[model samples]
Target: MAAILKDVMSPNPVSSNATDELTTVSKKMKEEDVGFIPVKEDDKYAGVVTDRDIVVNGLAKGSAENVQASDVMTENIVTGPPDMEVEEAARLMQEHQIKRLLVMEDKEVKGVATLGDLGVENAVETAGNVIHDVSKGNGNN
Candidate 1:
């Protein structure tokens, strides 16, 4: 069976508003252990804010903490519906050089998918080699 984006997506990812303060956004990102957050404006997904963006743009530029999330988010985003095939997602991710994707259903936020979520474990000390190991019938990593 073809894998679906839902299988790899992180449901209900931590998100924030474009108008929210940078401090608030930082706290949410850190507390959630997420590198990115979906940004919304006028009740619609506006863009995404990434940890790198903060470091490169906000901190390096010395943007005040009072600055809004909108000021730092990357607006040019690529999104996919929940039922989108994993290959399509992978293709998109490869084409865009993105590690994550937002999953939507009926234009409503549903989940998020990241490359890490799709990776198989590599530990080799147990009764068997880790996931996706060739000996156990899982696909090669």
Candidate 2:
């Protein structure tokens, strides 16, 4: 039996605008209790903003209010499809060194898949390897 991304991904993930203030995005992240948020521009998926990007790029620039999601968002994001195999998704995460992957359908944002989601599906080893690789700067660190 092949487990698909839609079976384990967090659907309809919280998102933000690329032009939004970093402070606003940070607040949303805090409120959502999430470390990452999808970024959109012109109603189209643009990139991803992570807590690290906030600290490293946003704060480093002086004020969060002065920073925009586009200023800190990772534009070259690796996305996956809803029907993708879990193992393949895990592999993509490992390859990208990213902890989360935006699940897209027809070029539209659909959901997100995290290493923890894989762990929840009993892919502990895969999740661990992903974490290790991402932590070691292999994914996007």
Candidate 3:
């Protein structure tokens, strides 16, 4: 049987509100020691904010204090179910050229799967391929 995401993913990932200021999101990132954060809106999982988003969209634009999480969050983020196979999730990450995969269930953010997770889970080959492809920057950024 294939390893599922729940086995390797970090559960109950930290999240932020869409209406939250970028400063708030940055603090959350710092407190959680995570670069990625799921975003919520209207009590629903809406999007994601990353450290890069804060730098590129928030800081690069204007005062980060004035920017909301929604202002820098990636709305069309790719997601997968907690039960998804590790190999399948790796493929998805390679295809999307993204480093992280937001694990979702019942429209709620369950956890996050990352290349490092794959490596830690003994999916080193898959993790290597994903890292290589994502570094190529071929997918939509």
Candidate 4:
């Protein structure tokens, strides 16, 4: 049987308000020791802010203190159901050129699945393919 997303997802992911300043969000990322933070609005997941987004979008825009999490967050994020097969999730991540997928249920964010998590489950080949694809022309090399 194929492994499900929930079996490898990082549950109860850290989230931040959309209105939060980049400075605050950056601090939260450091405190949580995470590279990504889901952005919330009206008690629902809105988007995701990553360390790269902070540096590229927030810093490049100047005055990061005035930048909001929503300003740097990736709005059109890819997501998956908790019951999705790990292989399916890997396919989605590769198709979307992303490293993580938000696990959602009934429009509620439950957890996040990353390439590292897939590796932990011994899906190294799939994870490697995803990394290679996502890194293409993205300066990840």
Each model's total of backbone clashes:
0, 2, 0, 0
Report the C-alpha lDDT of model 2 over 60-103, residue by residue, as the tens digit: 88888778999999888888899998888877776676778889
Cα displacement (Å) at residue 85, model 3? 0.6
Please report, in order, the local distance difference test score of every candidate based on alpha carbons. Answer: 0.72, 0.84, 0.84, 0.82
Q: Which ten-residue region of model 4 has the weakest summed lDDT? A: 132-141
Ranking by TM-score: 2, 3, 4, 1
RMSD of 2: 2.1
The residue-level lDDT of candidate 3 at 51 comes to: 87
- Model 3 residue 126 CA deviation (Å) reads 7.2
| Candidate 3 structure quality by residue, lDDT tens digits, 36-125 | 999999999889998877887789986887789998898998989999998888778877878899999999899999977865455576
Compare candidates 3 and 4 on lDDT and give the better one.
Answer: 3
Model 1 bad stretches (over 4 Å) = 120-141
Q: Candidate 2: where are CA atoms >4 Å away?
A: 120-137
Per-residue accuracy of model 4 over 51-134 as CA lDDT, tens digit each: 888887789987797899998898878899999998888777767767788899999889999877765455677566656774
Error of 2 at 114 (Å): 0.5
TM-score computed on alpha carbons, candidate 2: 0.88
TM-score list, all predictions? 0.79, 0.88, 0.87, 0.86
Minimal lDDT window, size 10, model 1: 123-132
lDDT of 4 at 114: 89
Worst 10 residues of 2 by lDDT: 118-127
